[model samples]
Target: MSADHYFSADPAAPARPGTVEFSVAGRDYTLAVASGVFSAGRLDTGTAVLLRKAELPTAATGGTLLDLGCGYGPIACVLATEAPSTIVYAVDVNARARELAAANAEALDLAGRLRVAAPDDVPADVEFDEIWSNPPTHIGKAGLHAMLERWLPRLAPDGVAWLVINKNLGGDSLHTWLAGLGWVVSRVASQRGFRVLRVARKTA
Candidate 1:
């Protein structure tokens, strides 16, 4: 596999643009996608599980949200649509992925609510009221942990983060690891070999 694919800051692969269709919260989506981005061909299984099993935001929900490691802005689009009152920040390291994500949001008419940006481009003062992700586990354990450490702290005091991880890819261990880091971790669901975890800050 090319190091430039999916996880790199700038993938060298051709865009080879395409579209991926999926449903969440009884709503259907057809988002723009391309080669060099994660899950270019279709909606990834782990992400499908996450969207299906996790408690999605409702129309009444209102706050700044996050879609970490957002590929072509699937989660970000869904979150923004589900909670029209909220704004979603979609963060990714892959330049091509960010481009595709922004384009997808624009295509879906969610550009006003969903903001796509490179990881470091997010404002320092911004905090998330909720976070959603199907992180890039292929990045390896250390890299994954570092990515989480970088974003999870940005959650508001009462915020929650929903994550889905492949069981064969150390899902359970990741749950334990988050607990060891003093975050409250809960296994919300398990389906199709994926673990849906709800993570939050420890309360007083």
Candidate 2:
């Protein structure tokens, strides 16, 4: 990884152009990428795991969806493509990543259903039916926890969040921490040392 953080507001590294190709739900995608973005070299392995393992929405699924830490909008595009009626909010902190995500969404003709925004740009009133993220654990435990604390509450009642974490990077600890916080956390899948956690509000 480059010294320039992918989560930086304005990446200092010079942008290097490229494309990342991947398939999801039997659909293929070739997205634009640049240096200083998260997993710019390819569709991140954790992201691919999350997308394949999580319960994808169908067209009948009607509600807002959130792709937290959306890097170039692969999950956002896939969700929009799968559930055309659902509005997908693709949020990230990096300007370059957001720009690339927006461009990719447009190129895929999913601009109408996908909204690529910065962390602070999402409207306060929106409540997501589902939140998908392969969060930036490199941000450190405190930062990662804070990010989750800030966003998980935005989930609508009965909503769920799908997350993929590298086991080496506090995946099990995160599962424990979420449970400690009174959230319902379940390990839905484990592949190549990555844990796919399905989290939801604890119910009575």
Question: Candidate 2, which segments miss by more than 4 Å at Cα?
Answer: 1-3
Candidates in order: C-alpha RMSD to true structure: 0.9, 1.2
Q: How high a TM-score does candidate 1 get?
A: 0.98
Q: Give the TM-score of candidate 2.
A: 0.97
* lDDT tens digits by residue: candidate 1, 39-155: 999999999999899999999999999999998888999999999999999999998989988988888888998999998889999989999999999999999999999999999
- In model 1, how large is the Cα lDDT of residue 107? 86
Candidate 1 backbone collisions, by pair: none
Give the distance in Å from residue 202's predicted Cα in candidate 1 to where it truly belongs. 1.5
Q: What is the lDDT of residue 184 in candidate 2?
A: 96
**lDDT, candidate 2, 159-182, per-residue tens:** 999999999999999999999998
At residue 70, give the lDDT of candidate 2.
94
Candidate 1 C-alpha RMSD relative to the actual structure: 0.9
Off by over 4 Å in 1: none
